[model samples]
Target: MNVLITGASAGFGKALAERLVANGHRVIGCARRLDKLNALADTLGEAFLPVVMDVSDTASIPQIITDLPDNFKQIDVLVNNAGLALGTEPAQNASLDDWMRMTDTNIKGLMAVTHAVLPAMVARDSGYIINVGSIAGSWPYFGGNVYGATKAFVKQFSLNLRADLIGTQVRVTNLEPGNVAGTEFSNVRYHGDDDKAAKVYDGFKTMTGDDIGDILLWLIESPAHININRLEVMPVAQTYNGLTIAKQDS
Candidate 1:
């Protein structure tokens, strides 16, 4: 199967791309960073096709959809994983820039990619879409604000698309994970403040990108009759976002 993954420069996207290639699947990965993409291509050998494309840039999507090499013409899976959280602050105190960025990337970018690829999938009546959402969508927090709202949109959109594609071979699944570790997600959200961002996952083990990658591969390889609509995976340490407690030394 030919697979396309967005935001393949780092984190979940990169891990997923590596796993798919290792399993002998042809993979096409897109990201804004050429260096990372090139490195991925080198590491994955001929199984990986790395493209420099930004999911937030909708205008360039059509060309990407049309210009796939012959080997990737029959794309069986698309992973919409190009998203992030910006400033962890209350809505009232947050930067408008951060809000816009989140909405543009999480919502608009997702729509653009789906619009570009869905028609072909629908025409053939065979494909799987794995949207990497967040538990933040189901449960809100003090500083979740726009980021949470964007993921909420992802959850709803996945359901609506599944409804619209009923009876067809296409499958849409929303994979929501909580508190993943070993990803630049926190650093990006904290605007490159690695030290400040590191505190969030300090106390215990958190889900790794490979964990999410394995789930994605499973969803696509399942029987055509079965559709895993929604899944939420998190480390035991991340019971729930609302269960926070302050510790006091006696």
Candidate 2:
């Protein structure tokens, strides 16, 4: 199968691209960092095609896909994995810039890629769309804010795609994960504050990018007749702490 994964420079995207190419599937790895993508290509061989892309820049997406090598143009699987959380501050205190950036990359970017690729998949009547959402979409947290909202859009958009493609063989799956470690996620969210990023998972056995890649492999290999609507996963050590209320100071 030919797979196209966004944000392939790091985190879940890079891991997934590595796993897929290793398993004999061709991968077109898309990201803004040419050096990193080129480095990955050197290791993955000719099966990996690295395309420079910024998912947040929706306007450039069409040309990027159009300019792909002949053999890589027909994408069998499209993974919307390009997204980030900009700030940990409460909504009222958060930067407007952060909110807009989250919206652009997480929501608009996903849509642009899907729009570009879905038609071909529909024409072929076969394809799989794996969207990397987050548990934050379903369960609000202290500072999830706009990041969570964007993921909620992903969840809903995926379901609506499933609905619209009811009679077709195309499948859409939203993979939501919680508390993943060994990725640039925290560092990016904390804006390069490694100390603060380290503290989030310092005491926990969090899931890794490879673990998420394992799940992606399964979803891609599932029977054509099956469409796994949504799968939410987290480490065994992770769970809800229940709701809370704060009383006024005495």
Candidate 3:
């Protein structure tokens, strides 16, 4: 199978690309960092095609697909993983720019990629769209703000796709993971504050990229008749906490 993974330079994307290629599947790894993509290509060899792309840039997306080599043109699996969370501040205190960035990458970007690829899938009546969502989409938390909203959009968009493809063989699944560690996620969220990012998982054993990759592999290899709608996972160390409330001075 030929797989296309966005944000494939780091985090879950990189790990998934490595795993898929290792398992004898050809993968096209897309990211904004050309050097990083090239480095990944070096390690994954010919099976991995490195394509420089910024998912937030809608205008250039068409070209990315058009430029694909003949062998990699027909993407069997589309993994919408290019997304980020910026500024952990509450919505009122959050930067509008950060919110817009989140919207652009997480929502618009995913939509653009899906729009570009879905037609082909529908035409062939055989494809899989695995969206990398977050538990934040379903469960709220302090400072989740726009990031959570964007993921919620992902979760719903995935379902809507399934609704529209009722009779088609194309499958859409949303993998919502929580507290994943060993990725640039926190570092990016904190805007390069490595110390702050490190503190997030200081003592906790969190989910790893490889773990998510394993799940992805399983989803892709599942029987054609089976369609796993949504799978939400979190490390055993993680769980929901009770809601918080503040009382006024009595």
Kindly report which residue stretches of model 2 are placed more than 4 angstroms away from their true locations once superposed. none
Ranking by lDDT: 3, 2, 1
Candidate 2 C-alpha lDDT tens digits along 1-250: 9999999888888888888988999999999999999999999999999999999899999999999999998999999999999999998999999999999999999999999999999999999999999999999999998999999999999999999998899999999999999899999999999999999998869899989988988898889899999999999999987898997999
- Candidate 3, pairs of clashing residues: none
Cα deviation of 231, candidate 1, in Å = 0.3
lDDT of 1 by residue, 1-250 (tens): 9999999889989988888888889888999999999998999998999888888899999898899898887789999999989998888899999999999899999999999999999999999998989999889888999999999999999999999998899999999999888899999999999998899889898888888878888887789888888998889987764577889999
- Candidate 1 weakest lDDT stretch, 10 residues: 237-246
Superposed on all Cα atoms, model 3 deviates from the true structure by an RMSD in Å of 0.8
Each model's number of backbone clashes? 0, 0, 0
TM-score against native, each model: 0.95, 0.98, 0.98
Please identify which of the two predictions, 2 or 3, would achieve the higher lDDT against the true structure: 3
lDDT of each: 0.90, 0.94, 0.95
